[model samples]
Target chain A: MAHILLIDDDAGLVDANKLVLEAKGHEVSVAYTGDDAWKLLEKRRPDLLVMDVMMEEFTSGFELARDVSIKFPDMPVLMLTGVQEHMRSDWKFDEDKDADWLPVRKFLAKPIPPTKLAEEIEAALKAAKEKKGKRPS
Target chain B: MAVSEKLKVIVCDDEPKMCSAIKIILDGFRPEVRTLGVEAELEVSLVSTGEELLTRMETDPADLVLLDYKLPGISGMDILGRFSEEKRETAVIIMTAYANIETAIQATRLGSFDFLAKPCTPEEVRYTVKKAAHHLIVSRHARLLAQEKKRIRFQFISVLAHELKAPINTFDAYLDVMRDMTLGKDMTAYAGIIAKCSERTDGMRKMIADLLDLTRIESGQFRRAPAALEVAGALAAAAEGVAAEAARRGIKLETEGAGLLVEADPSEVGMILNNLFTNAVKYNRDGGLVRASAAADGGKVRITVEDTGIGMEKKDAARLFSEFVRIKNRATIGIPGSGLGLAIARKLALQAGGDIEVESEPGKGSRFTLSLPAPGSIDLKAA
Candidate 1:
């Protein structure tokens, strides 16, 4: 089971998602803002990060993702946002083009099924593990 | 526009008599300007040379300039060319004894508002100046309106998207937890989630209603049915709506004073009261005290909602009532709010011939005072 850090400004979403992830036997911790998430990450790194794009500021999650990539290169980052196409059309979060700068392994649009969220988190964790294994130690 | 902005007009001519003649004519038109019902004041300044004119323009730019095309130092055509090149908004009127079609056409192309012969009739001066004033005011307003529209549309899209999507995001998660029976076994285990889901749905409904009311009020389309409303009844009613949440949070909710009456729409007052009430509870520390009081102060009925919550800095409180402004800090991180509540509440209050004011100190508490015109006050439509 992966230890996941879920960061979102909405407490309702944070609490509900934490329960779902915990039910699946994964350890989960939640932060209500990007800053709080960053502070928590500094204390103890999670195996994976699931964060919302819009929080304290528009690109706060992306900023946190970049920091994570620089600090904990092996930890996978998953982006979750709501109505992204409508709110921020400029940042599509497609890994093919956005991977270079976004520093995230997966992008899940909002109102996503719980199954899909869990599936993506698992896939991302597995991908990171494989990438780590290939690296010269 | 009902704007009291002064329109500065500068007259530059080498001739002293010509300067006074133009100034006297324009100055005499002031009373007639008021009589014509155009709400603009003209402040005329006369400069005998272009050097002084340029210096004064640098210090205090004139909205309109009357220049002699054949003057010494800086010819009116040369200055006109410079004004257009620099893109100053000053409307130039080129006057000359040697008025010719070629010069007039060239001046017109150089961006002069109008061309006139050396001795212009008062009627000609008045009419041209009047047209220039209209052009200046209307064009400035148009430019500002265009800019404001763009900004509002961008902000409106983002705010609407976030507000609408937040609840849906939460609702989706809650349903997912329910469907998978993540909590499992006991149906009662899901009851809290169900209730929270309902609350999110209710929040969204309130947001939608507030958005509609906000748009209608801003567009002057909101139909307000004003009646004599007793402050105590409305205050109690608003408190009743938040009683459960207040009790759950362990907040002490109380109200004082009675018999204070104001003429306003019931729904409008209810919305204002509920907004202040909800915010007081939502932002308050658990087990905090919230006191709502009403009284007649001067000729207005004032309702004050004081909360022992996480009060903001003086600067934050100043912009607290603006659109979509949520104080983002560790203290307020998990608070669920539309951020449009106080904005709409203040708007409704103002339209009903009232205003919402705030007084607060960080960590101590906050007091939001909403004042409405007492009964027998002037009509609200005047606003």
Candidate 2:
């Protein structure tokens, strides 16, 4: 089972996602705010980070993702957002916004299903493993 | 809707006396006009700087902003530029003690509602404010009407594209099959070429159909006929429809949740499943797997199509369901598509009181799930 970090501001949504991930036999860590998520990352890095775009402040998740990527380039981030289409088409994340930020690995819109989430996590883990193999140890 | 409520006004002038003079004039005219005139609840707040005016507008979004032409930090024209760029729909009246015709023309160009000379009368302030409010109402309504018209035009174009392309695509596919030994000729040498052409043509056909469906639904022409359907049976048929194409690509198509039931339009549901499956196969790596599964959960059934294909970038994945939007990185240019399939499927799912979702990553794979109400369970009357 993979260790996953799920960050979101909605308490009920976080709880629902935790239950779903746990039921699938994955170890899940929940963070209700971006600060908590940053603190968690400082301790032990998760296998994958599932975060929401709109948080307590504007672009909180985006800023956190940028910091994480800067510190640890290997970690993969999966962004969840309701305004995915708007962000993708209209917003341009350039060097001025965040220097170390790489494109997120996956994006799932709000009201996602448990099975699809599980599938994405599994696929991402597999891809990470393949990348690790190719890297010079 | 009472007329006694005072007209809230915000006055920004470096000279405090000028603001007081304007307020006094407005207060004097309040009692004289009673019938066919607004009972002026004229509350004026005076600010000395343009920055303060901007802050107040951001905080309260006042009904009207009376701005002085000259200010310490930012000029009235600069404020007007920012307000217009932000699309703030507030009535703005420019006031200047030293008035020039060029300044008045420039203020009007910058979208100032009206230009006023300083030491003006109370009647003029009242008339300008009233006229500006009326203009605001009319402009807002006009904008709404224009948006409605644009939406209608988008739907019309989508439908027209679909209606024009369907029959042509069908004919193209037939010609492709006939060119090879798949149907009539025993010419085995050109089988590969014929298969590729046919596949591309089929993709185009599906795209046209998607455009047509999107237009119909957006224009309220498409209607949902929810009925009890064997979910497994529908999956089987849709799979069968794409089986030959999958075989051509050496992809495996499998279904797990047969015999389940769902409440939806059979044709629309089938199209949704078919589009997802086809996308999986067409975009997959050689020998990739395409799996379709369904499960019953309380009052709904969840159907999913999972594939090991050339996945998408996160940005592209976000717009996977918007009409006529395709991922530029994953698009195979020679392979024809109108990029309306997922969007149409999403609309259909919503019409059935359900939703469609996707999960994907670059070079990994993708999965699409459809959550729908179970057949024979939904109350048609309430929905």
Candidate 3:
């Protein structure tokens, strides 16, 4: 199991996701803002990152995700987004087009059931592990 | 097309036969002007004398007028001078048999819109009327566009407020689910973070609500519930809402008032007092004192909230009630607020037949006095 870091400005969502991941036998830590998550990462990086796309600023989540990939390339990030419905069609995240900028193992729309969130986390962790295992170490 | 898109036109000439000719020519050019893409249609009215034209103008003025320079009773130059003197917006085109450079200069000096010679060709009349009609239409469109711009700006603000609120609602729902789960097991590990998040969300929610109220009130759509409210009760309730913050800062909060009654919406008064009290606590030095009380003014009740805190400059207090005007200074840095609280409070007070006034000295303290119509003191038609 992975030690997941849950990051969001919304305290309730952070706590709910923390509980869900903990119940699935994964250790979880939480940060309520981008600044908090940034400091936490610099101090000690978690094994896996579960975060929201909207935080203190509207683009904070994407910016932090990019920063994480630059500093800790191997840490897998699973993003939770609440703005998928409202984003303009042209401004939407295209997996192939935005891969260089948006590097996340998975992206999930918000308000998902707790069990669904836990399931996604497990799947993401397994994929990252398999990808790393095949790499020439 | 709307009625406002019609260009009212009056043709004035003493010779009925000549007036008929110009009227016929103008009527024939209506389609020609329409082809020029002028949305304003010609609304024609005929007046045979200067007196008739003057009387008709007094009742309902036309936007453009065709006046013969040689009219009985009042000369064309006299009519042009009168229009210029009164600053009427009628575009007058002078028609004279003596249409030389001197007359044209005189008419132009007297504020005539254009010159039309008698025995004028239909083609010349067509082009002249076309130009005048286009000017009227373009000016009308400009005015309407300016008004629409204002309306769109207000609508944009309202939409932005709703956009900001959606995420908060989702956050609130998540809190509800977690609270339910907390009761079932040990959730104390996240208790401190949860409390901080709860406080932050509540503050942001209040800011959003304040933003909505200001916009609705400005757009004349806010529904208010007015009643006879006891001053002590409203003051106490508002004070209680900020009591915890005051205690945490070691700031003394006090309220005292007799059975003074003010007729206003309860929620409005709550917003006003909450703004004042919150500012009192947030700006106060640690362990400072905040006092709220009311007194009887002539035909009105004076409710005052005084604070012993870092007061502001006179210039700062002058614009304190303006919407979105947060006073920025060294002492007030990082003070979280929407800056609409005082502005909304003042707006609500004025609507309820009352007003808010403030007095303060830098480094000494500040006091805000809210005066409202005392119960039955004034004719309370509506609030």
Complex DockQ per candidate: 0.45, 0.02, 0.07
Mind giving the per-residue lDDT tens digits that candidate 2 earns over B1-383?
A: 32544445788899988888777766544432334343445567778899998898887777678899998899999999999999888788999887989999999999999998877877777787767655654565578899999997887565555434433433443343343323334566446545655655576676666666777887878666888888888878878888998898888988878678888888889878888887888788888888889998888999988899888877778888976665542134334566778888898899887899999977879989899999667788665
Please give the ranking of all candidate structures by TM-score, highest first, separated by commas. Answer: 1, 3, 2
Q: Which stretches of candidate 3 lie over 4 Å from their true place?
A: A88-94, B1-216, B219-251, B254-270, B278-343, B346-383
How well does chain A score by TM in each candidate?
0.89, 0.84, 0.90
TM-score, every prediction: 0.68, 0.43, 0.49
Tell me the tens digit of each residue's lDDT in model 1 across B163-281.
78778877888888888888997999998898888888787787787788789989989778888888889999999999999999899999875878888889889989999999899
lDDT score for candidate 1 against the true structure:
0.84
lDDT for each candidate structure: 0.84, 0.74, 0.80
Looking at the true structure's interface, with contacts defined as alpha carbon pairs within 8 Å between chains A and B, what fraction does model 2 recover?
0.00
lDDT, model 1, position B377: 78
Candidate 3 has a DockQ of 0.07
- Angstrom error of the Cα, residue B77, model 3: value is 31
lDDT of 2 by residue, A51-111 (tens): 9886655588788888878887888788877564433455544534544454577666655
Q: Is candidate 1 or candidate 3 better by lDDT?
A: 1
Pick the TM-score winner.
Answer: 1
**Poorly placed runs, candidate 1 (over 4 Å):** A70-73, A82-84, A87-101, A106-111, A134-137, B1-130, B173-193, B221-234, B240-250, B258-267, B294-302, B310-318, B326-337, B360-365, B374-383
